[model samples]
Target: MHTLAQLRAGELSGITRLDLAEGLTEFPAQIFDLADTLEVLNLSGNALSSLPDDLHRLTRLRVLFCSDNDFTELPACLGQCQALTMIGFKANRISEVPGAALPPLLRWLILTDNRIENLPTELGERPYLQKLMLAGNRLQSLPPSLSHCHRLELIRIAANRLSELPQWLLTLPSLTWLAYAGNPLETEADAAALEGTAHIDWSALRLEQRLGEGASGVISRATWQRNGQPDTPVAVKLYKGEMTSDGSPLHEMNACITAGLHPNLIRVEGRIGDHPEGQQGLVMQLIDPSYRNLAALPSLASCSRDVYADDCRFSAEVALRIARGIASVAEHLHQQGITHGDLYGHNILLNDQGDCLLGDFGAASFHATTDNLETQALQRIEVRAFGILLGELLERIDSGLSDERRKVLEDLQRRCCQPQVLARPGFSEVVRELRSL
Candidate 1:
């Protein structure tokens, strides 16, 4: 975090990154002094509303973040920054995105929790575009030109006004992660779907050590004691109840309840009620301490792909077992009218024996399975994501299988990730293929 004093005193002249968050109300002209060296700029949590027309003087700037500000429009001068690739303006009041505001080399664009109703056609012209997050907006339709973004891998268009899913979006060759919940096109789950869930009061539970946390909530080790039942050790997730990059915590809880129970899924014991602070929470089975995430979350350079440890290696037998477990769970989820939008390896926890437990409903959403065609296509989209994970595991193999088995695995990967959206095999078929291998 760079202070205004250091910047004005020329102490931060050759810095590659600068963060100024002291309730700035206007663009500091002194920022331009480091135009020759600055590569990243963060002015978030400020009151700035606009930027100067000649803001392009920073020729080396590659990333800019102005989130939680009062800007009502995107700065058009951003397009003049030839090296710019990432632009984030989340949680602002911006309503307009002029075509001139987008840089030609753009890759990642985040505009979550804004009032934007439309996007500029120039967005489709960026060939390097990969991740596009526009959730919590008022968009009713997507520009057809976005179909030209063949490199796009992840997109979050949840909590919007759209009434239909675009065909082009479903067929994007590289699209693997997607979330479209809380939209007009989504089918609302019946309230009774949650009736079977056990209801537990917060007062009866004894909270213990912190377990973990994610974007929407924190999980903790706790003990639950029923009136006449023995005490049970469990994990409690207290929701943060904020609008996440994917969507709302309420929607995530709904999807979790609708998903019901499965062997490979983390079991939800009950719904938490009567919280001391009036917060929503879930009571779940505590996973064994021996389990760990299959891989690390995506790194900046990998963009939308998962990153594994340097020494990570899986035998062909273990790889196939992991694949079958994930495929079976995903197939069950799709059959339940749920799409595990974020199906990366990072979301899967596995024991030493390769038994898998898929968790994290943050990016999960409900889709109508009444329409067979739409349902099948949506499931196939997730198959592509699984294919990427399968390929990653295969890449780390040190040759534990026969030539024929390796060939079969490669063939399955190709079929799952085919660009012909609906033509890709579904999760059920994927499970069968893995078993056969």
Candidate 2:
């Protein structure tokens, strides 16, 4: 991050990226000095309400972020930056998104936690568009023109006012990750299983050191106090009170509660009862320290894909075990009408013996578990995500893996990721097929 003093003192010459969070109320005109080489600019956490009309002077700019600002409308001048491909205005008061305010080269757009009730059809015209985030909005419906986004892969429309799921969203050729909870259509029946869960009061717990933190909350080790027995060690997740990229923390808590338990899933003991600050949280089984993440989070260059270790390799038995465990848990989730929206390998953890756990319900959402075609389509959408996951594990297989078994896994992935969404098998079928191997 650069400072206002540095830019004014001519100390930031020829820089490609600049981040300014000085809480300014106006755009600095001196930024034009670096217009020749600046490629990325972040003016977030400011009181600024508008940008300079001549922002187009940054000819080399490709990315811009103005999150946590006071903008009520998207600056139309953004359309003039021909090289701009990514834009973020999250947590702003933006209600107006001008049809002509977007650049042709746009690929990723984030407008989360806004008051947007409608979207311009021009959004679908951007051929390079891939990732879109519109969660925590007031959208009533998605533009039908988005059906043209064949290359689009991930989207989050959670915490909206949508009355129904769009038919076109089901068939997006490349879509893998999707989150649409906290809408009007979500029914209580989807979470009926959550009713039987034990609620642990905050008074009956002894908080310990923090385990980790993520976009939605912090995980900490805690000891559950039993009145007539020994205390038990457990992990607790206290959700942050803010809107996340996926959606509200409340939504995630509900999904986790409803997810219940499976052999391969992190067992949720119960909901965190009364809290001093009225915060929402969950109590779950403590994971073993020996287990490690299957892969690292995605690098900026990899876009939506995760990054694996350089020497990562697994025997056929280990690979099959991991795949089967995930598939079984996926089948269990689907049976309960839940979809693991964020199913990347980074969310998976495994031990040396191949036992794996699928944690992180931050992006989970619920859909109809009935036999309707749309529900079936929803499951297939997740099938594509599983296909990508299977392909990743296959790529790192050890030489001892038999050629026939390798071909079997490859063929399963091919079928799961086929362009025709309906042709993909359900998670139950995926479990059966993987178990057969």
Best by TM-score: 2
Clashing pairs in 1: none
In model 2, the clashing pairs are none
In model 1, the Cα lDDT at residue 146 comes to 96
Cα misplacement distance, residue 59 of candidate 1 (Å): 1.8
Error of 1 at 371 (Å): 5.3
Please write out the lDDT profile of model 1 over residues 63-159, one tens digit for every residue. Answer: 8999999989999999888999899999999899998999989999999999999999999998999999998999999999999999998999989
- How far out, in Å, is residue 92 in model 2? 0.2
Q: Provide the lDDT at 48 for model 2.
A: 83
Q: What overall lDDT goes with each candidate model? A: 0.89, 0.89
Tens-digit lDDT string for candidate 2 (103-214): 9998889999999999999999998888899999999999998999998898999889999988888899999999888889765434456677789999998899999999
In angstroms, give how far residue 40 of model 1 lies from its true place: 2.4
- The positional error of residue 198 in candidate 1, measured at the CA in angstroms, is 1.2
